[model samples]
Target: MISAASRAMLAALALAAATVTAWAQDFPNRPLTIVLPYPPGASTEQVARMVQPILQERLKQPVVIENKPGGNGSIGTMFVARSPADGYTILLTTNALMTIVPHVQAMPFDPLKDFVPLTTAIRGILGLAVNPNVPAKNMAEFIAYAKANPKKVHYGTAGIGSPQHMAGLLLNREAGIDLVHVPYKGGAPAANDAMGGHIQAVIATISSTLGQHSAGRLRIIGIGEKERFAGQPDIQAIAETVPGFEATSWLAFYAPAGTPKAVVDVLNRELVFALSSPDVKKKLFDLGLPAVADKPEELDKRTREDHKLWGDIARQMNVRAE
Candidate 1:
């Protein structure tokens, strides 16, 4: 026999679920906005633009791309974090915001708790490029050269605590070489200094160094991926020289915490479909970003793991944000 209190509890639960289902069915009755925590024309923005049309078409609503970049992505990220949990405002950010930034500075919201991971949209492979004058063609040669000239060779990156900086730090630790790290305001300046001989090497994206490498102005030492990226197979993976070496950046989507499960499912299914389209894949590949669509649970697990991994690396290296 069902007691009165037990039946009432069951009825309440059922009513709440039905309400959420109805909300999901009515989602995006208005325009949806994707807040990016980086400036316009960035890799994140480009990837968002590529997927916007697909999302708009599938959702039958205008999808807005808003740039809210600052504080190494914390400013805009926090904005999205505090937004209403209506599934109308989404966060499109890089792994840096979730994994790298928190280790260096205080954030207004908890990365692990303030949002729900939707999916990983794209992955970017970092590459090590050296000026032609440096006596190295691959990771082995580069490591040997740095070893021979301890404290003499310097490498530039976007900034301290940036992914490129972490890649440089990891390389130094794993290769047991001493390469003085020189921080720049952005990757462009770092690449410029490398070309002008101010720095011997630069750890930046493959796209940033590809043109110079092809022109023989810069020699790519190695790529920071376990295997050569399919988009550019000529470059060898750094792991070939240093076993298990891998450092790649990625972008993902998220919804503010407390969003209904039904709304999340609808958004995930449609966006994953958008990311997996052939045309979208080609466009991303052309821009040096590979389209990657993983399940929500998969993205959630990866985010948590990277949060710890980068945090440990930062502490072990004594790296701090500037």
Candidate 2:
């Protein structure tokens, strides 16, 4: 019923739409690189490796992981921040890089402006634990013990500005305790001290000490979360005792800013698939990490809110460079 000219125009429009679709889908025909901001064999690498194989299977392409750690994740973060906005390069990073690093450092790239959200890989819990030699059996007892013996109970942090530092600072402010902080190069050493009874306590990833807690080496007092970790249900949350106190952290993926929406959508869909698989969830759970697959918008909102929250807390408690 249509005239030839009208029919030709309609066909042209259809072709254009098809071209856009193809353009979007054609991306990532090659291997994709996921830049990790942590060192090799780190938690970030483990999470990346766990999801990368599944994503490769689903996409029929490889998702490669590269470690570019240094300067408290600033170096790797900036590398990803400056990468081409073509979805070929992605960043598997912790919220600490987004929420904690920017507040404390003069960075080459802005965390909020330089990246496009892919998806949050996981939400992990952190716990406050002490050597078995400490006289505190629980949160209340620990606070009382620290209050009675000030500066005697030393606490170890992963680094001066790391999440362990944030938890330690938050704990001190909330529990009204002035525990001396000793910074280590990373979480392993700080946790080692806690297990060896050298330092009284240390705030670390639940997975970092899950083995110790299981082996009955260190005494876990409180978790910096609302609920008990599935991996460590015996340990109560700090919120239960501190009432209204909570500090949860996570890891997520981000593409360079201005990456195509179609590519981002594809990545998000694959991540959802990865999270839904029982194998993937089990790996994370065993590592004491809770799986949380968030859309791009949800991740953006949470990161922004955390930045504000941590900023205010750091300021109120006078948690400055150590």
Candidate 3:
């Protein structure tokens, strides 16, 4: 028994409140899919699975990891980009695919416009290594051999146009060495080939190769970081030999464009929190994959930076799909 005006006003307020709550709760009503452009066993996949549970715990939804690798990482990216803007499908990718791919080819979608960048999850540093049996024991010796042999040494990559490929290409151009480019279906295979001596050398991420480097199956001819890997500071950085050389492979998460800002913020906060957790950080650190979280704006900046940087390197090296 209320007046019509009072009842109407109460209903309007309740609807408004419900709409906002619905907007917040409206997201993630179903199983969310996070797409990985790389195949299984990739550091991107490894770290994504590491944090997947944390996100699920926070959101109360099961996160399904989908590996859609191929087309130089375009297939998975395009799939996520074209998905509904309801924040269900996410793209977990590396710098090479998200930023460097467009520079190398005309992709079906614009990375910046088609996807809402979620955040940078982790960054694994790159290292240039060679099999123990190769004539080159160190970076200088390796360069000497390459210079003398010229195109005889096969350089392995995660795949054509991948960051590992770009790293090798950049090193070749900078050092004026001609190493045969060999692209594998994924980084693990490329690393395995390099470790098995099937290929002469590989520029692989620290996370994938550090174990062998420690085990002595592979020798680090040169590393591509400003500083040496911890406990191996005497090993020397590639920049030490060539000067101005540093390349790191990174993993990032993204969502379809037009997703509600509220949902994006919620995920970002949870992701950063999960990454900073001692357990998560320790696990990744032991795996040689360091946790790196960048704000959406910072990740965007890095994307632009890497696109320009890798594009220049690719153009200079004349790197192309092979």
Best by TM-score: 1
Least well predicted 10-residue stretch by lDDT in candidate 1: 283-292
Estimate, for each residue in 124-163, the C-alpha lDDT of model 2 and write its tens digit: 6888988988888899899999999988888887776677
Clashes of 2: 0
Number of the predicted model whose lDDT against the real structure is largest: 1
- Model 3 has an lDDT value of 0.81
Q: lDDT tens digits, residues 8-81, model 1?
A: 99999999889888878998799999999988877888888888999999999999999998877888999989
**What local lDDT score does residue 38 receive in model 3, on the 0 to 100 scale?**
71
lDDT rank order = 1, 2, 3
For model 2 the TM-score comes to 0.92
Superposed model 1: Cα runs more than 4 Å off: none
By TM-score, is 2 or 3 better?
Answer: 2
Per-prediction TM-score, please? 0.97, 0.92, 0.86
lDDT of 3 by residue, 149-205 (tens): 987899887777788788787788777889898988777777788889899888888
Clashes of each: 0, 0, 0
Q: Which ten residues in a row have the lowest lDDT in candidate 2?
A: 313-322
